[model samples]
Target: MQLTVAPIPFFWSKDTWSAFYEEIAETSVDRVVLGELVCSKRLPFFQDQIPGAIERLIAAGKDVALTSLALITLKRERKLTADLVEMGLEVEINDLSVLSYLPKGTNFSVGPLVNVYNEGTLRWLASLGATRICLPPELPLASVEILAKEAEALGVTIEVWGHGRLPLAISGRCYHARLHGRTKDNCQFACEDDPDGLDVATLDGQPFLTMNGVQTLSDSYATTVHQIDQLRAAGVTALRLSPQSQGFADLCHQYRALVEGQCSSEAVLNAITGQTPEIRFSDGFLTGDRGVAMSTPPIAART
Candidate 1:
């Protein structure tokens, strides 16, 4: 199975972002999807570094792709989408609106943010020159199996969200700014303070969600420690691991070990938990009631 590193969903400094990719280039990951996929306002901070990052990842023998912004509204954002084709890399379409602007006959991949829930959608994207797709993180294994089969028949490659915070929703409002009593336009870059996203909790103080500028993600990292085999059995060609601020390159190594059968699922899960014992891990979206579900053991889930 191929291991892919997803673009950084949180806002990090250019130095940090550059260093992260520099480290990843030395890892065992097969592909790296870099560039902005969240707020376009954050683009200018690190956009100039992208070209060099792409060149480095490519030189390291990795297939690299550029990701489109999840929600595009501004005219400038529209132009940005229209220009991804010229990047000369696979443009991973995160928003459906990008489809209208994609250069004619350009081979593209679908990001998990776009709703690719069923065979109809899968086949439709395939028909439109989608050579690869990362299934939405919320999909169950049954849906994954069906889509994987469709991808196989259509000669498209299938990928799944393997690890990192689950991106729940994107809104026009900037929650991080609103939390500090500001609006989206004049928020003063509040999100940059929280590189991994500001953690939100329930009334009773339970860690619940993470608030990026406009995107909401799960507080617990969404992991698929046990689902690797199932996904491979279902024809998933790669696993997209979203980038985090710290301990990320190590994560790439751990995942590569798991993918290559060098470690057990429980061992990998235990090791991950050992690294950050406080945060919870979930594969419920692929195995149980909801995204937070984590009752069944790895062996049990296999059955």
Candidate 2:
């Protein structure tokens, strides 16, 4: 299976962001999707750097695509979506409103944020020139298998959420700004402090969701190591790995090793925990359980 790195979801400084893609360029990843997938206000800081990053990734032999923002509300956001076409790289449509901006018959990819739940939705997107689709992380194995079959018939590549925190939802309001007691517009990029995301906790002190700028994410890092064989058998062609701030290039190598049967899932899990020992993991969404539930006991328990 091919490994694809998803766009960075957190707001990182321009230097950190540029360095992350530079690291990605030297990895075993087959494709890399770049560009801001979150708030529009943060784009100006790193907008000029995208062309350079794209050139470097291409020079390193990686297929690259740009991502549309997950939520588009304002006229400026709409203009940002429209300008993605001018970049000449494939646009991974995270928001459906992006469709209004693309010309008819323009080939694009759909990001996991879009609700592509059934065969009908899959078929419709294919009809609209969608060449690739990363299925929503919450889909069960059965639904993925069914959709994979349909996608095969339509000649569209089907991908699954492979690794990273589950992006549960996106909002018009910035949670980071609100947490700092400021309005979204007036907020001074508070999310830049947490490169991964700010972890949320329940009233009783249990770990809960995570808050990025306007996105709510699952507390667990969802890994497909346990389900890779099943996904491959079901015709899934690629795994979309989300960018994390620490040891991500190593994470990409571990995933490549696992996909190639050079390592065990437990080994991969150990490598992950070795980097960030406090991290929790889950694959329950693939089995049709509560998304936070883990299907297996922790192979490498957190310290």
Alpha-carbon RMSD, candidate 1? 1.7
- lDDT for model 2, please: 0.92
What are the models' TM-scores?
0.97, 0.97
Off by over 4 Å in 2: 297-303
lDDT tens digits, residue span 1-303, model 2:
999999999998999989998899999999999998988999999999999999999999999999999999999998988899777899999999999999998999999999999999999999999999999998999999999999999999999999999999998899999999998998899999998899999999898899998999988999988888889999999999998898899999999998998888888999999999988998889974778877753344212
* TM-score between model 1 and native: 0.97
Candidate 2: residue pairs that collide: none
